[model samples]
Structures are given as C-alpha cells and as structure tokens.
Target: MVLGAQTTEESGAIAVYHSDDLKSWEFTGVLEFDVTNAQPGLSPDLVPRGYMWECPNLISMLDHSDGRTYDVLVYCPQGLAQQDEHYVSSDQCGYIVGRLEGSTFHVTRGFTELDYGFEFYAPQLLSTGDDAITIGWMGLPAQDDNPTVDAEGWVHALTLPRRTTLHNGVLHQVPLFPLPDKPQTQGFGAVATATCEHDETLSLVDAATPRLSTWHAEGKLLIRRHLPTGDETRSVVCAPGEITAIADGCAVEVFSQSFALSVQIFEEWQNWTTETT
Candidate 1:
C-alpha cells in the first residue's frame, strides 16, 4: 500500500509499505512524486477533508487501450491547497495519480481517476479471476457525520463492486453478476415488441392480488413482460452473447464487455434457462 498526504501545518509527503498477512505491516517509507506539482487533480468525491497528507489507495486495472494492466494510486497532501473552495472541503482526504511498473510505483499525471456519483474513498483492488474489482468507503474526511453511522454504527459503506476496464481511453465500470430479486406485481402490457432505451425500466404484478404486490426496477437491466407473476430479470439487453442480464442491484449501470450489451426477457424466473427467445 502507498500513502501520501499533507500535515495540518502544511508539510507534504508520500509513503509506501508492504504486508504479507495484513496483520503485520512494514513501512517502506515515502515514495517520490516526480510529476508535475502545479495542481494535483485528486478526486473530490471521496476525500472531503483538506490539508490531507495521509491515507492512500491503490487501484489496479487493465488499460485495454494499451493491453497491459496499470496500478493507480490516490493519496493526500496536507500542505497543498487549491484556490477553489471545493478542493479545501475535507481535512481528512486527498488524492494522487500513480502507476505501477514492475515492482516500482511512480506518480504520473494529476487527474482524479474516479469521476462519477457520490463519494468513493480509500479504494482498493480485488482480484477476481479475469477481472479486477474496485471498492472503497463511500464516506470519507469526517466519517462520523455519515448517516449510516446511526443505523449500523459504521460511518461508511463500500461502493458497489465495479468491474473496472478502460474503453476508448476512458474508464468504465459495470456491476457484477447475480441480481436482487423483485416481488412480482402487475402493470406490464405483454411480452410483445417493446421499444428499448439505453436507460430502460420495467414492472410486473401479482395476478392474485395486483394491489397487494409488485416488482419495481431493482437493477439497471429490465425486461418488458406480462403482469403479475413473471420470471427473474435475466433477459439479455437485446441478444444473447451480446449483453446479457447481469442480475445485481440498482448499482448496475451501462457496463459492456466490448462496447455492446446483452439482453433477454423470459416468461418466469424458474424458466429463465428454458426460454429460447
């Protein structure tokens, strides 16, 4: 793990460490930041605190545009403050952009890799066979103020697991497989031809008690179908082997393996495997 930050008094520095079992940690001392120092464009979503010179997160993902995998580092510097008010919002947060080459890690550009919804901090990489999963604390800087602290006594929650990949020189995230199940209800017209939108929505209901129950959009991918009792939301986006339904939760967004999506709709959940079209 690598860490970089600034002290409350404005002293700036970066460091590295090594751990075999996570239980025992050996500090590898500070890492050298040789890149441009004008404005380190760190992420503002995750780390809210200003004057940060600590806490570092390293993310490893494939730069498919380049074919090889790259490791990116995010850290803080306590002394470096920008003229913008947004940069000084948190004292507990800061960021950086670094890449890993062989065993050596070096800071490269000065832009925040994470540019999306909500605050995502302390991000780490998880190896899942062929993919790298990125997850981090949704709350940072002052963790105490987070609303989840009241319910779970924990100030933050991990961002939904995102399969990270580079597309057309841009980073893209998609939700993992297996999805949350929604209760069946009424509303859908039929499984006939329906117009599809990149951002689509669908619904169904229970025939016995249409008023008693219904299944709302629990994930990004939805299949237009009949009312009451239908199967799971496993229909591919349009065609099989194209962009199939990856049943996660609302956390799923427009994630494509190449650049297209897989879609399919079925009669019912149990018959998902049996449905041909």
Candidate 2:
C-alpha cells in the first residue's frame, strides 16, 4: 500500500492506493480521522491538528513490548490556527500507531508530534532491516522572509538522516552516524556537548549576528535566536545531563536524552565560533 495526502484546507485526509506488481496501481479509499472520537480513554482532551494533511508515510514495525506488529502513519498537517495551543508549529508533522486492515488503519495510539522544532516537516521514511530511517525538510511552510533568501538565494535544506526506534510505546530518534567530537573551525558544521554541572549557554555567532544558541538551565532546554526585529525562541522541558548539538550550514539539530530540536538558522554562512559559559 502506498499512502499520500489530498491537499485540502477544509476537509483534508490521506488517500490510500494499492499495487500488486509495483508497476501498476489502483486508487483505494481515503484514511480519515475524527479527533473528537479518537482514543477516548487515552487522549480524550486532545483536539484536531489542522485542516490538511500532507506527505503521508505508512510503515509496519514490530513492537518489542508485546510482540505485535503495528503500522505507523506519519504526515504533515497544514493550516493550523494560531490559537491552537496543542501544536507548536503552524505546520506540524506527527504520527499515529495503529494496525492496518484492508487499507484502513485502526489506531491504537493517539497522535504524537515527530519533531518539536521550528523547521521540521515533509518527512520521508525508509525501512532497513528492522529499523526505520527518516529524513525531513529543514524548512517551514508559507514563510518567505528567511535571511538565506537574500544572502544565499537558497532557503531550504535537508536534515541529517535519523534513525527511529519505537520503545515502550514511545518513539526515539538519533543521528544515523556518530557525530565528530573534535572542534571544527573553518566550515559550517560543528559539534558541542553540554553538561548539567551548572547552567550553561552555547552560542554560534558569525561576527556579531547571532545565528543560534542553546541554553540548558533548571531542567529546561531553550533554543534562542536573535533576529533583526526581535528574539525568537523555542523550548522543551527535559532534564538533560548531557546534550549534543550538530550544526550544518543553516540547519542546527540538537539532541538530549529526553528531547530533540531541529531548527534552520537563516543567518548567512560565516566561520561561526562556538562559545560556552
């Protein structure tokens, strides 16, 4: 079964298609969800995501907890209202864990956001052996004021490939390859580690323009940026004993034991210096 989304703002849903020979295909039906009635006991207070769903991906995986295989559906939703506090991004990507029966998914777990960041969407998943690897667009939807647009004439990039694993009814992601620990000085990529011995701040700056910074203090992690008009920030609550960050050109991705964040730094390319204090 190949899954895709019908782009509609009002009543958007996922379209299902089937193929037997991998060359010929037939349109099946649509996979629709009613947030009002989904997971009444588990997620009774949850609300609908948005008006449209896009970039739909469906895959099956074995649940190590119960020895049952389940299907995971991942998609990006659009047209989310600003007043909706349930989601962080105006356009968000999430997943649903369920079982598929005849082109239909009977969901077992409620919706969960895939990445808690400012620039994560349109994720594509690939299955290798028993693991699922995903790569996402490191950009947002319907935004055109990026600094890279004026400085570099390009505004988007791809995130580093991440390995996804389902454990204890929750999904965890990490970089597919181990990151370098040695300090880099001349390029757009760098790696840094932080500890909880005291409150710490990690900043990447090109001369005076602030690209991005990560602050870890009081069991909370904050990603801060200094824009031309004001400061833009995104935060997550996690007690990270040690945190790792990887920056590539205009994209920065951070990971800890409890959470992860991926953001696109719009600042022009320069020899960024890493500061710790």
Candidate 3:
C-alpha cells in the first residue's frame, strides 16, 4: 500500500511511503506533482506556498456525471498570507483536484478552501470501497481560548462524517445522515433558503444569540461565529443557494452546494430562532 505523509521541503509536499503489510513500511520519497496551469493570474485560486503542510490525505473519486475519476490531495498549509478568498487564519484546510499519472500527480485545478468558517482543519479521507468519506477537526492552531476548556474541561471536536464527490471539477461534501449522536437537544439546526423573499434578510441565533449560522446574501454564502476569543465573519462568492446548519452540543457543521463549514460552539443552542430583516 502507498501512503502519503506531510512534508515541507519542496513547496508543501506529501512524502510517499510503501507498505506491503500494515506493520512494516519503507520511506519512498516525496510525491511529485505537475502544477499544470496553477500559477498567478492563470488559476482563480493560487496554490498557497505554505511554509508547512500538515495532515496529508490523498483520496480518489469517480465523477459519475462524466464517468471520470479524480484524485484529491487534501492538506492543511500553514503560514499563508491572507487573501480575498482564503482564510483569515493561515491554517485553513483545503484540497487540490487532479489525476495521478504514474509517479506524478497532475494538478487540474488549484487550491480551494474546503471550509470558510472560523475553525476547520486537518481533514481525513476514508475509502469505504464505494465512497470517499471525510471528517475534520473543528479547531484552529494556537488559538485555544475557548470557554469549554475552562467551563466544561473539554476541547476540540471532529466534524460530521461526510461523503465526498466530484462534479464539474469541484468537490462536493454531504453529511451522512442518522448520525449516531446529535447534540441531544442541547444544540440546534436551521436551513437558509437559496433565495429569501425579495429584499429580506434571514438571521439565525440561539438562546444566547450567538451568530453561529449561515445565510445566503448577494450571490454569496456568509457565515458568522461568536467564539470565546472573538466574533468573526466569513463569506464565499457563489451562486445563491440554500444552506443547512446543524449544531450539536460541541460543534456545528454547515452544509451547502458551494462549501461546508465545521465550527466549535460552546453557547447554548436551545430556543433557537430565525429572524428576518
């Protein structure tokens, strides 16, 4: 079996390894890649030259739409400069869609943010014979001032299990339903319609009125989060679409056709309300 490891020597690389059995391993080398058309002004999202790339996850998906398979390299790149479409926190997680040609991976599309919320990183892809499933951590690096650690003595969380697919050269992730454990009424769920009534605004909040929700606005998806550290907002430029957000006791994952967001919330999710303005 061939596995990928995180390395940073050659521009955010993934070190490849070979293993005949699960127990023994051999250090092969860095996974070589051909960044085809991935450059400044050529690609919409420039491939971040990360100082460090962590948690390398390599997975493949068959785009049934056109009957073509694509390999996705998911990783967390640190020390990225803030951009209009990138994350404010440099440690954002994202993926590259490409095809593996022999020993070299040919990058078809550049880097794209997997999540646009306040906290998301280190996504793992699981091959289940038929589907590519993903789950990620809902915490950022070096920012652990969450109230849960002081109040509940707990911290960090894994995102909802999601099935991934590739459509039109883009990755789509949908949560697997009937999750074993939901927030147990200690959390909340809401859906933001693709398009609200003309000249209307939809707002989602909990008993504490934390801005832990997403809404469709002006051809974009906007997310707001109220954390112990501070309040922040993130937006994605996409065609108007509906969004579903679910928050259990510890974490919240927002779903949309354009992006998926997983964030940690310590606030009470009871008595949730959606307001129009």
Q: Rate the local accuracy (lDDT) of all candidates.
A: 0.41, 0.68, 0.66
Residues 184-253 of candidate 1 have per-residue lDDT tens digits of: 1222122112233444432222334321111213322333334235422222222222232232211112
After superposition, the stretches of candidate 2 with alpha carbons farther than 4 Å from their true spots are 6-9, 32-49, 64-67, 82-86, 182-188, 196-200, 204-210, 216-219, 268-277
Worst 10 residues of 1 by lDDT: 184-193
Question: Cα deviation of 130 in candidate 3 (Å)?
Answer: 4.5
Q: Which stretches of candidate 1 lie over 4 Å from their true place?
A: 4-9, 18-28, 36-50, 76-108, 113-115, 129-131, 146-155, 167-170, 178-277
**What C-alpha root-mean-square deviation, in Å, does candidate 1 show against the real structure?**
12.4
For candidate 3, which ten residues in a row score worst on lDDT?
268-277
> Estimated TM-score per prediction?
0.47, 0.80, 0.80
Model 3 Cα shift for residue 24 (angstroms): 3.5
lDDT of 3 at 254: 74
What is the clash tally of candidate 1? 42
RMSD over all Cα atoms, model 3: 5.4
Could you give me the TM-score of model 3 versus the true structure? 0.80
For candidate 1, the per-residue lDDT at 130 reads 33
Worst 10 residues of 2 by lDDT: 268-277
> Across residues 84-180, which tens digit of lDDT does each residue of candidate 3 receive?
7565775868877788765577887777888877788888889865358888888887877665665556667788888877776667888866532
